[model samples]
Target: MSRDSLSPRSRLVHDALRDAGIPGEIVTLPDAAATAALAAAALGVEVGAIANSLVFWSDGGPLLVMTSGAHRVDTAALAERLGRTSIVRASAEQVREATGQVIGGVAPTGHPAPLPTVVDEALAEFAEIWAAGGTPHTVFPLTFDDLVRLTDGQVAAVD
Candidate 1:
């Protein structure tokens, strides 16, 4: 679907991407890609090629971890590496408050404010990766470098 036809949140992501100098167009999936596996199946790509936007509550702040779909985040390991005492999953309300988007559609960017972001180093293995576009049914392709730049993120091992 065209950008004009995108949902409000998806359109916000589209505009944010454009402003960020990303040339990739947002693609609306026929079904909701609420999880990495679903998105991968719909896009016909390896699940690892999907960037999962995971929001965590750490030290009273929100941290966005753009992890690979292949594995779950090792919270303790990640916390230790980041010098954080804890990094627990955010609740649905917290996710929405921090990202201004729902859990399944939280993009790396386009939140109400810029969040401290971490890009999964494992994702660099893929030449191209897809990320949620502010909604579960929308997504866009981007390079690993594009993710780093778009989110102004620090690269780290998420699992």
Candidate 2:
């Protein structure tokens, strides 16, 4: 499948990538890529090459963690990194409300506001990475720099 032929969220992701001056084309897979392992297997890449857009609720507000698939975001460590007391996983509704996309399909971009974003340092190992394009079956290729610029994310230790 192609990125052009997809749902509204996927299309929006595609357009956003172009608007952000990033070279990304939508890739549709037969499998439901709801997890980093699944996406890595489907794309035939390292698990770290999958940029998992994770949503969390912090004392400050909604936080977006663009983490590498190979590692889990240590929330307590992340909270310390952000100088916060706590960080909790966002509810499904909170995730949708904050990112304007479903839980399994949230992209790094296309949120209503500029979410406080943290990008995993592990993702830098890949020249190109794939992130969900606002849908479970959809993804778009991106570079670490482009991902940072597009999401206005800060590079940090997520795990």
Candidate 3:
């Protein structure tokens, strides 16, 4: 799709990726990819290859976690590793306030600012991974290493 055809949020994500020198094409889907299953189906990829961007509340700030769709995030273990008392799921308001995007559509990059981000180490198993493009109906593909580099995310066992 042309750059002008993208939604504002998706455009931001596209621009951010370009500015970061990451090469990928942002694809617009005919349907919403609100869930990993949906996104996987739409992209004809395994669910495990989908990177689910999630926001959490930790140390009174927003934490972004890009986890594999195959497993749930182990918040307790992750929190302990981060030396935090706890990490709870952020609310819709908190997510928007932090990422400037709503749930089901948060991208690793293009947030209001650089958020403390953690990427599931399991995602490295996939040669190519798909992530939301700041919208439920848009997505982009990238290598696991590129994902880590673009987000400047810490590689951790989130699940």
Candidate 4:
């Protein structure tokens, strides 16, 4: 679909993408793909190619982890990697407050403000990566390099 027709939230994400010089555009799925497995299935790609946008409450504020679908973030390991005392999942309210979007549709960008983001090194294995587009049913595809450039993320082994 055209950028002009994107949902309001998605339009924000689209604008962010374009402003960042990313060429990929958002696409809406017929069904909601709230989970990485579901999104990978809908997009007919390996589950590992799905970049899950996970929000965490850590270091006294919000953290965004763009991790691979095939694994979970090891909080203990991540804490060590980030030099933080603890890392915990953010509440739905906190997620919305930090990202300006709900849990199921939190994109890596388009937040109310900038966030500390981590791009999984494992995601660099994929030729392309897919992430949510500000809503459950919308998504956009971009390369691993695009993701790093878009978020100014720290590349690390998050899982």
Best by lDDT: 1
Candidate 3 C-alpha lDDT tens digits along 1-159: 777999999999999999988888899999999999999999999999999999999988999999999979999999999898899999999999999998999999898899999999999999999999998899999988998998889999997
Candidate 4 segments exceeding 4 Å error: none
Give Cα-based local distance difference scores for all models.
0.94, 0.89, 0.93, 0.94
The residue-by-residue lDDT of candidate 2 on 1-159, one tens digit each, is 455468878777777887899878888888889999999999999998999999999995899999999999999999998898899999999999998899878999867777988999899999999999888888889999999999888899988
TM-score of each: 0.98, 0.94, 0.98, 0.98
Query: lDDT tens digits, residues 44-110, model 4?
Result: 9999999999999997999999999998999889989989999999999999999999988999999
- The worst-scoring run of ten residues by lDDT in candidate 2 lies at 1-10
Residue 63 Cα positional deviation in candidate 2, in Å, after optimal superposition: 0.5
Give every collision pair in model 4: none
- lDDT of model number 4: 0.94
For lDDT, candidate 2 versus 4, the one ahead is 4
- Worst 10-residue lDDT window, candidate 4: 1-10
Residue 104 C-alpha lDDT in model 3: 91
Total clashing pairs for each candidate: 0, 0, 0, 0
Candidate 2, residue 96: lDDT: 91
